[model samples]
Target chain A: MTNDNNDLATLALRDVAELVEEKLIKLLPKAVDLEQQVIDAMEYALLAGGKRVRPFLVMESSRICGVGESSALRVAAAVECAHTYSLIHDDLPCMDDDDMRRGQPSVHKKFDEATAVLAGDALLTLAFEILADEQTHANPRVRCELITALAKALGANGMVGGQMFDLLAENQDLDKIRITRLQRMKTGALIVFSGESGAILGMAEERRCQALRGYAHDVGLAFQIVDDLLDEEGDSDDLGKTAGKDSKAGKATFVSLAGVDAARTKAFMLTDQAIQHLDIFGDNAENLRNLAKFIINRAN
Target chain B: MTNDNNDLATLALRDVAELVEEKLIKLLPKAVDLEQQVIDAMEYALLAGGKRVRPFLVMESSRICGVGESSALRVAAAVECAHTYSLIHDDLPCMDDDDMRRGQPSVHKKFDEATAVLAGDALLTLAFEILADEQTHANPRVRCELITALAKALGANGMVGGQMFDLLAENQDLDKIRITRLQRMKTGALIVFSGESGAILGMAEERRCQALRGYAHDVGLAFQIVDDLLDEEGDSDDLGKTAGKDSKAGKATFVSLAGVDAARTKAFMLTDQAIQHLDIFGDNAENLRNLAKFIINRAN
Candidate 1:
């Protein structure tokens, strides 16, 4: 993928995210009068420096499925909400215990711990609320399908379960397969859900959805592998979050279990597999193909 | 308000809650085993005995509007999920910090804080998942409406907003109106949402829904007023949660500012107003009328 490809993916994501943000701003009730708090927390996390990878996947996958822009925007917003909630909770004292997120004070640190917890809970609930809104999409079955996909991705079988396994693996003699499963649940599940849910709305065949799910799974793993490698070699300023915390915590990471070179090689291989799977969609998925490459090569 | 009416309402609530519990047990996913922690927390808190007021409002209000049992059951479950999430979060160390919930250890105390937080997040997301499921309802619009209603009730204008105010009011002076506003937002919003959401499914008329909202608001405030009085007079075992701690914490309650008799009188007035609005439903809202009475006079 060329720089132009990454730029196009970034532009498309920014445009869709802007639309979703506008819709969210309007959909929230004015009566609460806590608009400032809601906006502050939302913009703080969303507009901060991290790449909008999940939302980008949602938009690109939907586009690949030939979905309408409006429908794609809803799914993008919903996925972002889920992603944001996880970040907030993961930063809590009992979890990752990070004080910074995306180059800013973590929600729990900026606000109070209780506020951060509530904000995450509120955002989590709001994601479903946004997706389920009648005006967001026309299909009830599709909406339901998206909800199921998201729930599974975020619930025990997805992020939280992965977090549990990661916690358990700390300082333990964890094997390659077990480590991969943990990473898959933690990050891969939501990424896969983001891709497949968009396809569900587009009336895509089950096989195509499955193939997209496979692509997402591989890319998601590759993304984490690269992240692990980056933590070892990337600049702290570039990463936004504190790098190398994984090794300090004795958490088994791709770069820890295998060498940095091995992780980098694995990332490339996974990206190739993802791109190959998108061959059936042909050039229609050029943007998604490029996005996969960008994930592997991203500096941050 | 009579003995016969109260007894009938009690029996109905117990019966419906039991049925809803049974339905939930089956609908839960077996593959996602991490759900057990959340499911146990929900069951422990849910079965610990409140009036099942919110779920009953969902069921009875839906019946009043002539919606079918299935839709009502789903909505009831969604309401319960939201309610459960609030309780779990409210019990956290940084929040109310209560050790006891429903006469037992709070989820945070029963499990760890991290598990409690995840359980709450799971339950919160699960509500929307339930609404969005195709098997839950035939109408897409209805599912969307349910999601939006529950979200609004749980978000800033409702539970979170109220909680924010509560956090601010701690060790601070608050006028009666401010206290009422806080209580209304925290507890009343969801109550109003429950009845209005049920009405939305049955009758699409905005005016009727508004009337139901009005009814819910008054009843919700009335419900809190009684709770204040009960904390001063009710038994711990009977109430099922820690009471009398609000005064100790210097928190504002209706009784703190208005006195017990005044608060009691206010509750009666609110309940009357709630009943007056139900005249729109005429004889069709007999259950609602009884429910309004039940909200004010209950010991727990």
Candidate 2:
């Protein structure tokens, strides 16, 4: 892995994560009764933690667009909820069949499969609920845009469709273009949404939003390639997940189809393209440029 | 079952169902690729069709409030999407473990569990997406309100929590009050939302909204009690579902706690209370009044 002197901290990611962490707990409903079981499962899956990439992207991107920390934090938390819900459902026995997520026992393993399913459902519902609130944004139009955007990113035609393609891809060999399209729908959609959210909240000009979206798109694909490489090359302990499952499942991923050397080169090249998209922001986009570099270089 | 000469036709339910049916198919994205399996599962689950009670409630309530038929139709379709999503998840092997719904094999039975899960998830996402659309309501505020209402009715503190309570209730003997609370959370919350949605779309006065809410509450409870009665007494063929599963599972229900006679009487009393809440609207509420009566008396 290529280590960089500059990391996400320079971008206020720590502050964003801390604020999002605090708000996530407050955002969760109290387990006052019998239903606490599912709530417990939800908190376990949500708070067990990931690197908080989506939240960081939402907050930092929103910050660059001059959106308030408070509003960005709310949107960030909602993004995490949406991300966590996807992880929970994806790790189900019928899906990825993973037993660990973010280094913790998967929701179905920690709780029951039924609890896991309901917890994911509740989390997904909560994400929309949070975005629909006044605290997320003062303008109803802005809130509606956020809601629709989030829905589009994760709906049947987006992430869900991508997952379906992935399941099918395991049986049939897929070419690079098909795999790229699958990865875009599967993971890139949400990443694009994460990057675009701040602009939507800040009501940034169309061109700026498009610029951020382009940057996000390039980095998002690069990020997935790195993930594919890690799945093939990294250990589970470092990845904090069951690594190499892609190869073991006969899955058609970039790393599986393209040689590791070519895959790594593609990731780096894509990261460069991503950084180029942020050139319009000049010095102000320094953090985003470095963030792209960091994505391709991260070990876990 | 209590037979009534007047049925849902008096409320224009058939027209609402027809329009909502068309809109539902339109609202669902076309499956153009490998992901068609999940989309097919979604369509099967959604279009297999329940009685379309939620859509009817939304359309009729909106009609009484002078909201346009087109706007009501969109909201109605959204409500049905949410309803169908819940039903899909509820019938999963991990949850109710039912095999039949709307006289068709459950999603999990028809397709694979993964497809069923994704289909349910996509339907839930589609519901929020539909509600967030400008076509659903011209005002962004109204759209936001609808989104929040649907989320509140379905999230961890709402229907999800209620389902958790229900799963726990099966292990221990519960009283009628507890059963009522569980039912309120599980099914009643969505039903209440169906009734209140028209007013939310109309931006009706607080008192009028409260009236619809109250009417919805009573009718929702009455509707559940009748469901319990049907679970116990109705044939599986008539119900178009696997009846006696609740009793088979030894799940404590309103009918289990209170004798059939008491449960039946309570349903009628609640129906009367539901009808009384419509007094303010007088002639305008006749359809709602008949709707409430029809809810308690429906054989299915």
Candidate 3:
């Protein structure tokens, strides 16, 4: 946001924010009278916008799967709430110990550690609430399916497990396999769901869902590889947070294990594979293809 | 658990735990490889094992609604997972700052804060996952209703809002009405869901659901009043966690505002009202009626 890098990705996110933000604001309860501090913190963290890439994936994926735009937007906001919750918690004093996020003070820094924790918890809870609500879908079965996928993506074997793995990696010597697994679990599972959501909503065939998931998996890894690249090479102003945090924390990343050149090549290859996975959708997937390229080329 | 008071409530909990814990353990993925620490912490907190009151509420409510015991157990485990997650978070240094729970080290005390945080998160996610799974119910509609209720109960306006109120109370003088509202939001919402879950599962009449919810509301209040009383008069050895924490932290509670004798009378009145609400169920509500009476009589 501070810098105008990754024009297409930025544009895609702007489009998503336009489609998703108003509804997200409505979904979040406004603090009226007493005990409003944590509510304030929840709103603050959510409003601190990143590129909204995950929401974009939900939108584009749904577009390909023929889900209604309004329904897709609901899922988009839900996933973003989940993503934002993870970021808030990850920025805590005990986790990554970051003081800033998305070019602003982290939730814990803005409020206290306790408020940040509760806000994150509330946001995560809101995600499921949105999906479970009748507004998300006409059929309760479809809604239940979505809730299950999102819950699994966020649970122990998914993001939380990946976080645990990442933390332990700081003290242990992690190889490429373990690091890649960590990256996939930490970030890939949710991306897979984001892309797969539209398919699920539309009740698309298993073949199509798998195709979207495949694209998401490759793109997710490419996105993380590029993140490692940016964290290694970019500035604090450009990244909106500290650079070289992976190295500083002694955490093993794709770029850390493999040098910058190899990591860049891997990212590019993954991007290509990701685009190939979108071929089944033909012309409709042009935006998705562009998204993959934009992901690797993003400077910050 | 150690006090052996409230025989009916304790016996009901023991029955529910026996029905629920095995399924809960199976649903939780065991860590056979890397990133086992957080998983360990999650199990530790869950296995620390209180009297399992919430799960019992779900089981008994479902039984009266004619739901199968096996099916009811799933919902019971799901609610207990949620309850355990809340306790783990509430014990963090930034929250209640308790080092022990149920005569054992708190999750954050046994494991590091970061692990405790992730474990709590994973458990919460797992609750939704359990609810949404096909194994929980044959009809997704029932599952979705359960999930929506649970999510609402756990979200900002429910448990989280109540927690925020309690935290703010440390700095402000809260009146009886405000404290009652706070208690409802923080603890009452989940208990209502726990009682209402069975009706939703069994497709009971709205009247029945409301009656169960009415009973739950009074019982939840009585339960809290007894908790405050225990905090004021019971020792740490009996309560398993620190006693006198409410006064020590300078937080306002029912007992603090109403005094010991008045609070005791109010709890008994609430317990009586709770039992009366279950009159429609007749002999089938025996355990439920017993649970209401036990709430005010529990020593710890």
True contacts kept of each: 0.46, 0.80, 0.74
lDDT of 2 at B117: 86
Give all TM-scores, in the order shown: 0.90, 0.97, 0.97
Assess the local accuracy of residue B186 in candidate 3 as a C-alpha lDDT between 0 and 100. 95
Candidate 2: list runs displaced more than 4 Å: A1-12, B1-4, B8-11
Candidate 1 TM-score versus the reference: 0.90
For residue A151, what is the lDDT in candidate 2? 96
Model 2 docking tier (incorrect/acceptable/medium/high): high
Best by DockQ: 2
> Against the native chain B, what TM-score does each candidate's chain B reach?
0.93, 0.95, 0.96
User: Compared to the true structure, candidate 3 yields what TM-score?
Assistant: 0.97
Better of 1 and 2 by TM-score: 2
Summed backbone clashes in each candidate are 0, 0, 0
Interface RMSD of each: 2.9, 0.9, 1.2
A1-300, model 2: which lDDT tens digit per residue? 234434554345566667888999999987667898988898898789667878988977887899998899899999999888999999999899999988889999999889999999999999999999999999999999999999999997889988988888885878898898889889999999999999999999998899889999998999999988888989999789988889898988888888888898888888888888787777888767767767776734
| Full-model lDDT for every candidate | 0.78, 0.87, 0.88
Model 2 gets an lDDT of 0.87
